[model samples]
Target: MHFVVCLKQVPDTSEVRIDPITNTLMREGVPSIINPYDAHGLEEAIRLKEKVGGKVTIVSMGPPQAKEALKKAMTFGADRAILLSDRAFGGSDSLATAYILSSAIQKIQETDPIDLVFAGKEAIDGDTAQTGPGIAQRLDFPQLTYAIKIQELTETTVTVERKTESGRQIVQAQLPALITVEKELNDLRYASLPNMMKAAAYEPEVWDVKSLSFDTKKMGLKGSPTSVSRIFAPPGRSGGEIMDGTKDPAATVATVVQKLFQQNIIMVNPLAKGGKS
Candidate 1:
């Protein structure tokens, strides 16, 4: 299994700042980490590689600094890593991100055919959960989002359980499928001394638009379709007064319940229809 995991370097949630003028994330100075959900996917890939004996390649699209995330992934025993960095790809939306990542995957496939592509449910920075599906759509591969378990796999097919608001759903797709993983999948393992040493010395292969044989017009900002206009934090609510009910707990509780009843906050209906007649 030549598992390809798509990782993203996202702004640390606590450090996220948006530019009011451009609606762009203030990434220049913000600390970054591998997308949390992608971390789970990487762990799964590593586990699978251990079982089946194949290579796991980590791929990411971001600025030069993102190589740090790739190196972190390499510490977990990924066979190789690639960073797709170019000025033209700056300010890309989900569609453009998926396009760029898809191009990178295609390039990797040329060297060794990719059996599967794993991604996170969403990035904390974007929270769009659109890039994974977008890549699958662009590559014409089957997409299984919110996957919680890999039920089974074969040379030709893969079965998984996807989590939904209603319940868990079982889905089966072909081998070259794309999966957006959930945090429930697996916990990440600590890197051993050898793996850490390997990662410390390994420089991820950097691929620019030219390296991918991509036309500059179709690979960067020119290829992107969406743009952010402005960004700002939402207004906060003012504090409310707290009620005093220490004198008589039951009396105060009854009084509060009565007030809620009068306000129609909670109602008892003798005639409302779902009665077990």
Candidate 2:
């Protein structure tokens, strides 16, 4: 049950701003933290380790500063941490990012066969919710997204509850599966003094593009098929007339209803089914 948690360092929601020229996020100088959903994944991994007696490994792909995120995860009792950083790896889209992570996971598997891989549903900044599935696709592993709970795990199988728009679904997948977890999964535990001390002294294993025998064109911006042209706020709403309801409540209410009806803004739909109007 060697758990590998794929985490991302993201911009603080408050400090996130779009670059005018690049149409990309202005990530520089923004405070970073582990993706919230990934935190739940990390907690679940630690819990599994405690139950079954195994080690948890946390990994991330970002700029050098992302080591901060790895260190933070290490504080939460992860046995090892790794950071995949390289100048050539900058500006990677979800596909390219997943490719890099999948390669790292393969490298990790060479040393210790990975029983599971977990990731947040999506990064707050990207909000694509694509990387986890992408990684699972590349690795040829069964993927469970929006996982609420792991009902059971065994050497050959995994049963889990997944949250969906309709309701909870109980799903079973084969072993060596990848899961993209939701924030509602579980609450994180506080890091203890001993873990914190160890984490402060910990040095994350860093890997660059060359270290992975990566395809040059598929490494970074060159491999990314999508590009943001621009990002701007929606236009402000026009001022609306406020009905003078204070003068005569009944008259105002009647007038408003009459106006709405006249404008066909509150029409009764005769075709509505089940008498739902």
Candidate 3:
């Protein structure tokens, strides 16, 4: 089995700032780390590799600095790392990102057949949660999202427990499926000394636009259909009125109810009766 995990380097959300003029994230002088959800996805991929005896490869699309995120993933026991970086890929929305990633994955499959693809349910910065499914659509692979646990897996099929708003669902899909995982899927492992040393010295293979064949119209800002218009903090909430009922408790209750009714916060039932028989 050969698995590929998609990872991303994102600015630490706690310290992130927005450019008021451009309405984009201010990445300069901010610390970057492997996306937390992607880290969990990487952990699950490594665990599967350990159980099934296969190789895990990590792929990322970013600038040269994003190689740091790939190296970090390597410390978790991925066999290889690939970085898709090029000027043409700048300002790519989720759609363009998915296209670029799909192209890179197709290239990887030329030599090694991929059995499974792993990705986080959403990138923290964007939170659109569309890239994984987009890649699956492009590759014609079965897509599973919000997977919380893996129930079983074989050479031909894989069973998973997926989280949904209504409840949990047990789903099974054939091989060569793409799974976008929830952070609840797995906990990250501490890398061994040897793996850490290897990661520290590893240099990921970088593939630019010239290295991959992709449509020029389906990349970068030109391919992005959505753009942020403006960003501003919400107005601060004001303090609410306090009702003191220490003296006239019953009268105060009646007054509060009357105020609520006047404000339309509570509706009155004219025909309803409330009494003990």
Best-fitting candidate, measured by lDDT? 3
TM-score: model 3 vs. ground truth: 0.92
Q: List the residue pairs that clash in candidate 2.
A: none
TM-score of each: 0.87, 0.89, 0.92
Off by over 4 Å in 3: 239-256, 269-277
Superposed Cα deviation of residue 104, candidate 3 (Å): 0.7
Across 1-277, the per-residue lDDT of candidate 3 in tens digits comes to 9999999999998898877778777888999999988898899988999999899999999999999989988988999999999999998999999999999999888989999999999999889999999999998899989999999989999899999999999999998999999999987899888999999999999999999888979999999897767766567898977999999999999999888888988887766686311
Per-residue accuracy of model 2 over 178-203 as CA lDDT, tens digit each: 99998787889999999999999999
Clashes of each: 0, 0, 0
Q: Give Cα-based local distance difference scores for all models.
A: 0.88, 0.90, 0.91
Question: What tens-digit string does per-residue lDDT give for candidate 1 at 1-277?
Answer: 8999999988897887777777777777778898999999999999989988789999899999899999988999999999999888887789888888998898778889988899999998878999999999988889999999999888889899999999999999997999999999988899888999999999999988778766665555677777655667888887954678887889888888888888888887768787411
lDDT of residue 243 for candidate 1: 70
Q: Which residue pairs clash in candidate 1?
A: none
Q: Which stretches of candidate 2 lie over 4 Å from their true place?
A: 19-22, 236-253, 258-277
**Which candidate comes out best when scored by TM-score?**
3
Cα RMSD for predicted model 3 = 2.7
Ten contiguous residues with the weakest lDDT in model 1: 268-277
